[model samples]
Target: MIYLDNAATTRTAPEVVEAMLPYFTEQYGNPSAIYSLGSAGKKAINEARRTIAAAIGAKPEEIYFTAGGTEADNWALKAAAECCAGKGRHIITTKIEHHAVLHACGYLEKNGYEVTYLDVDRDGILDPESLKEAIRPDTVLISVMFANNEIGTIQPIREIGAIARERGILFHTDAVQAFGQVPIDVEEMHIDMLSASAHKLNGPKGTGMLYIRSGLKIRSFIHGGAQEKGVRAGTENVPGIVGFAAAVRRALSRMEEKAGRERELRDYLIRRIEGEIPYCRLNGHREKRLPGNVNISFRFIEGESLLIMLDMRGVCASSGSACTSGSLDPSHVLLAIGLEHEEAHGSLRMTLSEENTQEELDEVVGHLAEIVQRLRDMSPLYEDFMKSRRDRT
Candidate 1:
């Protein structure tokens, strides 16, 4: 199959698997134990922490392990809100955020805190001026995603961070989609907290990290053990952690080359789709988007029907975030970027990887064009519109 859904998750790298094997069997000891094997486990875990921390320009002590990006997002948003209650009960985030942040904010609203959902422009970019205007005396935290999962729009995080820093409000970014694929420096960007998942970068699932800047106190998310410096309580997934570090190191080593290749392919697919397909628009900022993302809204067809057709043709793709695949609702990201309900319902997201080639994209595009035409041919909307055009002419 030609896999084009890297944004949903990646196939774990063989190198990462090789690096994790020893930890699973030979070094399988609890880091909290007092034995030599336990000490070794602790050392490995610490090394993984340092590796991830250094990647984001954070200190080792500031890195906390979580189950995945969702947990990290919850910890950052909810814990920060509770911890900074004295400072304020108001939080600011964009309408295009992953549902993890949006749902957490909903919970906070029910609990008496205020959350301002900011809007993005037509290209799915959050304006810093809107953020500034939304801030109030009661605002204590600002959470914006580093990159949109659906549209792949990279936000102006540095500008937003600077604004939050000037106002003394904590800034957090959900970097799950941007962590290994893009360059990010927690210090340089003035980000107080950041969330990333290992699986997004070819590492093992069930392993992720939250970089909370030093001296930033948030409440413990999981309550049982004293692991993670008493902030996150659970036995560390030593093997997965090791694999995560290995993946991060491997990706950082060749990020520039990999990104260039993926960017080339991304643009090629975008150009092919827009040039060849009728009544379809590319989603997000064309030049300011992710290096390996292609989101398009095809008119006169349903996204689900197109996805099924693509799947039958041996190409794996998604219409929007995988998390909401079963919801039957139009994508919030697309809607937030000003797409109408029908447009949002007919979107397709095709994310790539360095492993993909131009040949694969060519096949996907060819298959996609035929599939779209087939589906649209069966669509009453397409027939009606064509009839209207003929009548007018």
Candidate 2:
């Protein structure tokens, strides 16, 4: 099968699985216990923390483990708002963020904190100047995604971070899609809070981390028996943590080579699809997007039908984010970029990984072209447009 949905999640690497086996069996003791086995678990967690921290140029003590990116996002937005409420009750974010951040912002809105949903350009690039103009005296925190999950648009995070830092506002970024795939230095970026998940980078699911910039007065996220130094609670997933570190180390080692290969194929895939498919538009910035992401919209064809047909043809792709795939509504990301509902409904996101071969990409594009053509042939929207053109001619 040709699998091209790495933006949703990646296959767990074999080395990551191997690194987790010992933790799941021999060192399965509770980390809070004083026994040797338990101490081993605790030590492994610390080591994993250090590995993740070093990957982002953050200190180990500031990294707090959580269930995944969703939980981390929820913690970052909610806790930061509460902690900084005395100073202000306002937050700033963008419309193209994953639902984890969007929903968290919504919840904050219902609780009386004001949130500004900043806009992006047609290519899904947010202007730092717009963010700068939106800031007010009451704005306490700024949250922006490191990279767009659906369109693969990389944001101007450094510029945005600098703007927030200059104003003394707490800056948070949801880096779930960019954490291991791209180079990230939290210190250099001036990222006060950041969220990442292991599953996005070929590690086990159910593991993630939040970096809180070595104390800026954020409150406890979860209240229970003092886990995560009382910042978060509940027993740790030792095996998951070990696997996460292994994946990070492996990704770091192969990042340059893997990224170059993926980027080459990504451009190839985009070129083939756009060159072959008619009435198609590429989503996101061509030069500033992720290395292995290709999102396109085929006019007059429904994205769902195209995806289903591609699946039948042994290609696995997605219309949008996995979380919102069930919803019939067009993608929020697409809409934020000024796509009409029909165009948004026609959008398809095909993300790749190091495991994806160029041959597989070739297969996917062939299948996609056929599927889009087949769907458009049966669409009345296509018929009407063609009839109008013929009459005009």
Off by over 4 Å in 1: none
For residues 128-158, write the lDDT of model 2, one tens digit per residue. Answer: 9999899999999999999999999999888
lDDT of 2: 0.92
TM-score of 2: 0.99
Best-matching candidate per lDDT: 1
* lDDT of predicted model 1: 0.94
- The models' CA-based lDDT, in order, is 0.94, 0.92
Instruction: Please give the range of 10 consecutive residues that has the lowest summed lDDT in model 1.
Output: 212-221
Error of 1 at 42 (Å): 0.5
